[model samples]
Target: MHRLIRRPKSVERDLDILSSIDTKGLISRRELMRRSALFGAAATLSTFGGVLSAAGQEGGGKVTVGLDSGAFTPILKTFAPEFKAATGIEVEFASYPLGNMYDQNLLALRQGTARFDVFDFWPNFVGDFGPFLTPLEEVGTLDELNFNDIAKPFQQLNIYENKIVGVMIDGDMFINTYRTDLFENAEEQAAFKGKYGYDLAPPKGYKEYRDTAEFFTRPDQNIYGLVEVTSFFVYAFFINQLVQLGSEKGVRYGELFDAEMKPQLVNEIGEEALRRYAELTAFMPKDLAQAMPWDVGRQIFFDGRVAQANWWTDMPKGAADPKISKVAGKIKCARSFGDVTVLPYGRAVGIAGNSKNKEGAFKAIAWMQQSAQANRWVAETFEQSLMDPWRNSMFDDPKSTFPLQSESGFADNFASVSKELLASPKAYLDISIPGTNRYLASIMQHVPRAVTGQATPKEALEAMTAEFEETTETYGRDRQIAHYEEYRQRMIKQGYWS
Candidate 1:
């Protein structure tokens, strides 16, 4: 049965002081860590039954969640009955289209409507949604929420201004997937080495990646070098390359913006990233200019028409599914090329501040994420769910299963590569300050110009930079600067390079 495990009164007071000191910028990072550790210990030693009784005693109630239409929605619907049976809290969803999810959720919160007790949102929306959501720490202690179980990169996504703002429900980092049959073929390897002057293997850098793509392209055979999402959400793909390029060039903070909030993409590094991006299109499908990751990208890869694909973790799992993929056992996974990999999109669950049933909402979130059995079920049902591994236990535990673990040759390999990628020292977090969606939308608008030859890479990046500058000014430069500083500092503390 679900139980509300509240922090002790003394620990709560200490947390308030800690939060205040952190907010006022009066505490050093090291000291903050020390105090946080002590507080964690104190809370763990405290009681878990003082605030509320067991779910059986609390009686039946309802908790409505705000969600977008996606793979996650169906999973939640499937598991709702289980949660209700166990906790007596009926799970209901207020579904919205993905395109308008942010607006609908924000409108409800801004109006203090209490329309949803819980929200399933993109983690990048933390800055905009933070004030309207209750910190999970207040709903439950770190121990109760199993905070330490989450991966380091995703752990940082849950925190905003030192408060635990949400819990990561999906681990959506970009990974490189390729056809092992192509790479391992004796004739193909020999031919590649003879022509490129090096042994053929999975690419480790941009130069090798480009050469590999060019070598594999054979239009007459219906084979191409690569496939990637290039429409609508294309900005994410662009950022993936841009961040790695910046990391390789030793650009500061991975080169999205400077300390003063100036755009960094109007420079040489940005141009080169876009140029390489555009060049790759030559090795992709003819219709790639309008491809989306969910359909075209996956369809092309699954049809075994492409040798390589850089996509979210879902690609490897989907590739292994024989029902939808002709390349089932021929796939392999690795970190995206370069010194660092970018985390593009992921979902997080949070309780609404205006909810009358905050306790029930936290129970639902905890049930889905903190419960070991439930979490494993979600992660393993990859074909039916988009949830990827975000917890250490999911990978470290021998008994934990992945999609088609016994049947798919690459299941273990994908898990291993995912663990390595998430823990990589050079992994870059996405820009998640206020107006992050708008900032990314600007890139989406300008990227097509470069990809379609309507504008040069420099011209496109210059246009994007101008839009970024205008957005910063529109959002109030000083306010955005403060938000970025706090966001960057948090990322630094989490081991991401500046």
Candidate 2:
């Protein structure tokens, strides 16, 4: 029988393991197999509970969810009915501003209010809630759920001391969204290729990225190159880049307790990465440096005012709308390249540690992540599902490949980038340090100095090292170092390092 063949689109099912490519370097085959074996076991266990699929649940009691307001409203609302029908549990959903949603959730969790059964959290806040979240391993073994199919690095992300404590709800991996209309022109493409000795594509490294930014920067046309966010998300993105510059694990070595964990005062490579970040952004418009620029940063690209943007998956949708996006037909997507590395961030979900409804909560959390709810959400919302593989089937979906009145170039570009991201093995990282919020805030202030030629990279690294040491010490270095060690071992086990 001849099977129908479909082409991949920017919105189609992705084949790239966008966040899975490990850059910690080579390791022994035996170790590689060992980690793979553990992942295999977890993957098998992920799908073990087929008890009540996302079919629909009914009215038992309201399980409240504290969620950040996002574009996936329709999908989220749709799931409520399905979940209610399947489990007889009604959902009481409350939306919050992104700023303090997690903090609010934690406050409620710590107070043992049971006001919300589930809380929506970004990866940065996962560490904050780790101590309070009930490990998923307690409710369902990794063998039961087919965890491997979800995404490459998510299961490992939920782990704390061998316990799988969370379930991933979205596949929000980072990618470079570029303006193809500007780059695809024969003259522009030729000029870029001639200058760079490579095809005119989204940047593959920091130097190229900077060059492209400068190349496409036509301020006369109100267009800029290399648009970036300087918010909390930006800091996480910065951390990822820092890892790419350094050896395995970058500035964050393993925990003090872990054998693989080493205490390092500074990583020169990481310092350089931060320096580059600040230098690039120093040329950015001043208003772009605020704590909330990412939300509006994509509009700069969508309006055809910027040549390229470094942002998460949600940014592309801004360009999807024809009215708002002058470059709706021209925008494209790809992974942000650097030394061919993928440092995973923001692929975390965890249960509250002090919940009375542990069983119900686990079931609810697992249902949202494992069932059709997650896959359909991506299909309908055009948002990248959390940083994982649920979108794999959507790679070539018809809806993703629609030939709209807009140019096909945008779709094609996005498709190519998504494919590249999905094809690689994912590398996961933790931002759940006890004082990550404060540390990142400080890094934001100081890292820019180094990038803008104010401080040497070594100076920046020393400052960061000192800041981290001070904060971690105050927040309990022993505990924080333990988590760092676990993170390091995880990288080693994944063959990110020898």
Any runs in candidate 2 off by more than 4 Å, and if so which? 1-58, 71-75, 141-146, 193-199, 247-267, 286-292, 340-348, 381-391, 394-416, 422-428, 449-460
Tens digits of per-residue lDDT for model 1, 1-498: 999999898877756654443222222446444535532423212211111223334445799988788757777775565466446677887788888878988888887568899988888787788888899988887786787888888887856666888888877888899999999999999999999999998898998899999999999999999887778878878887788787777765365888899988877888888888888888987866445445778888989999988888778767877788899888888777886867887888898888999999888787676545444454445556777777887766423446355445465787788788877887777777888878988899888789888899999988988889998998899989988998778767766774
lDDT of each: 0.76, 0.57
Misplaced by over 4 Å in model 1 are 1-60, 290-293
For candidate 1, list the clashing residue pairs, or say none: 253-498
Per-residue error (Å), model 2, residue 5: 19
Give the candidate number with the greatest TM-score: 1
